[model samples]
Target: MTKYLVFTVLYLAMYAHAGSVVLTDDVVNIRNFEIGYLINSPHTYTIDEAIQAEFTPAPNRLSLPSNQLDIWVRFSVRNASDSVIACNIHNSISYFNRVMDFYETRNGVILDQKHIDLFAWTGDTKLLHGTDSVLPIHLNPGEEKTYYFHFVSPAYQYFEYLILDDQHTLAELSTKNIFPVLLVGMLIALACFNFLLFFSARYKEYLYYSLYLVSSIIWFVFEYGILSHYFGIYGMRGHLTSYGLLSATIFLSLFVKKVLQTAKFYPLQNLALNSTIVLLVLNLLWGVVNFFNALDISVYFFIYAIAVYFWVSISLMRQGNTLVKYLLAAQLFFIFFALFGILFYEGYLPYNWWTRYSIAIGVTVEAFILAYLLSHRIKLLKVDLETDSLTGAFNRRTLFDQFMQESKRISALESLVFVIFDIDQFKLYNDTYGHPKGDDILKIIIHHLQSQFPESSVFRLGGEEFALLFTAENAAAAQRKVSDIRLAIEHLSLAFPESRHGVVTASFGASVIESGRIQNFNELYQQTDARLYQAKHNGRNCVVM
Candidate 1:
């Protein structure tokens, strides 16, 4: 008799522990529940059968076994407060399950039933826009209601139910959604900036990157349900999502190829990129032909493309491609977050804000890194185009460009100074010491001027001749700065046996124009050239201002 009594008590305690959830105004997240699931069940059960089915206490995390099964979660909540309570039952994370039927019952009589088909084109308009399964209910004082959730999907899903007051739901959603929205906005801004760069520089890589960003933006917005919820765009979910991924693959490959100059540097990698692009184009066409049915296979194509990109990046990095470092870092970030998201979806990691939005967060980081890489590339290209290779001074073309730009900005308070100078006897120096030593002297002269003036203002205008452009308060200030430059050039004690002096020296001719005295660059150049001849006539290695 004692053994039987102990067994009975244990059984009753087990059932009681999984019994009704007593709800109060303070109860925000509901946890206690009874779950009964069938793995690959051959037959479906009716609502009556499901209501009478036996269930065990649910674990903290309930993982689905297979898509070919049914799951039922039951929990009864009784209002323990005097005032009416409005609550929402929904998944903690935003993910769509194919078929979710929610039922509210009182003593085996149904109060409310909702069938949610997330992928359907038409459904309950409110729920259709929602990313997750939501069931809102009102409980009067002392009212008890039993809730049942039945789920079926083509793929495995994990549902973590949350019961919260309406205000708490709003607050929680706002807190969760704010970062992703901001990240998307940042990505859009980056895309726009890249577009502008593409227009300004006419770089194919920038256009490809902008396109990649646009596709990624589309993918993230639709994947997270923002388009449907906020913008009321419900159609073309699958096609758009697949199109975004496919087009992103194509454009990113183009961007990498163009930026890395793979065809010129690494022919094999270039061929690989070309092949990947072709395959993706085929996949894109396949998607278009098959419609939404092709969406299931699009992810695999994307994964394969990303693997190719990663391999190419690593290979280039191994071959001493310095720019590949940024690409590799971006790839690693994306892969890490993508893997973490997969783990979260597969129930290995706990559901949290970071886990839920890991992909978007990673992509955002990757986008900025790539953008920085592109900007760095552009800076390097600009440097190569504008500067002399030997002495690191602005070339003749840049000299004219700078003068034109400065002309536009000159005002009544500003004066422009143009100085042209050359080595007093460069030909004799080159003949005596050979061209290489003459080259050394030219570099030294340019270096001396660079230390005093902005590098952009100091120009190597072919051979040993150079030009300097600067702004000053007045003519006196401009003359003082030019004299200082002449002195600095003389101070560079480079060997030049052909010079009248033992050390190398240069002659300077400067022309200053005050504000409102507008002279074109050619006129200014002619004036400075005349002064240069005057300086040579007066005495070699003197300043003619």
Candidate 2:
């Protein structure tokens, strides 16, 4: 009776000591765990050694520093159902560099074992699928098993484990992966659109934008494990990620320079942007030879680049650049999310959907905004090309084009008047005063002309010479308008020390195309030129009609 009692006591003690977890649902998140780590050590731990080693209770999520270390994590689960159930043991973190070995044992007898090393090149195509990292576990009613995970990595690690039904796990993983796939598709589409715009418009900025988008797509493909699923090459993931990011940065800097015309307007910012590009290129090269150190150094450059871009954008906006304001708003939105992503990666924030994909979201928003901004910029550039730089009036080319268009609609009901004017003794005035003062005089003349003929279109044909085209009811009305403008110029009495008048004046020549006249723009221009020459000969301050 004493022997039997001792045997019963031993059996009950064994049952009580078994760390079995009863599963009540399709998914079981095993959070109660313990972890032990060995730094710069060989992978030679046996089951007994692992069991005997000291382990501390892990937090809700385990994070390991980036180092050459091996980590051992222990956990157990039990089945409470009447029938046997098959489930998948999933390590939720899918970082590419990790080499994971899973060992399953029940009552000190090994039941199954599996190894997942993504860096290995020799594998079946399906082996590269991210889901293959999960281990298969079978449990009979009331059976308990302990699982040991031996993880080794050369990069920082995050750990979370789940016990899920095979079907449920597949469904969940597919649903979870859909988001990244959609993001990739969106990025590719945007890149293609920008490429098309580049070729169609022949704008170099669009080309740079497309290249930046392409690089971002490449980085996200590897970062999100989509490349691993298709290519099964994990060794290049880090290198490619670094290369893509650096390339994207370089192209983005170039795009900003072109879009903002930084060389012309913001020379200091341009120099800083170029310097960042050089640093990024050097960092990319270093990453090819020594990855971890390069990665560590790159973070500072990235921060610097972002700061410079932000500061330059703000400065431009403050200088009354309308396009830069839009760009600044878009960049602010992107920077906010980018900072969140950085904080999440550094373990300062919880890993939620927004934190996990914040950078991607920011990139999408920025891409769209940038594309719209580029189109708007193209329109503004067209306008600027048609305008005279010295005087804010239409250039000779634009004036001729407008005249031709207006000529097509000439009729008896509408009369056209063309007037040419120039500053009197302007060459002598320019010779006496430097070109800087000459420019001021020209600007003042344009301001006065625009103010007098607010409804007419004015054109700066050449130096100190301007033309105005207006619609009038009759020749008398057009003559009256030209006489008023000539009198206004004489009355201003602008001081010109070298001129005989001692005050700046203007000479005007007017030509009227009466109703039913079908004169071409060049013919009208010739007539106006002849009259202007006559006016110049008949004492420089008078109007010739």
Strongest candidate by TM-score: 2
By TM-score, how accurate is candidate 1? 0.74
lDDT of 2 at 469: 86
Report the number of the highest-lDDT candidate. Answer: 1
Candidate 1 least-lDDT 10 residues = 60-69
What is candidate 2's lDDT per residue for 369-401, written digit by digit as tens? Answer: 888888888888888889888889899889878
For all candidates in order, the CA lDDT equals 0.76, 0.75
Supply every candidate's count of residue pairs whose N, Cα or C atoms clash at under 3 angstroms. 0, 0
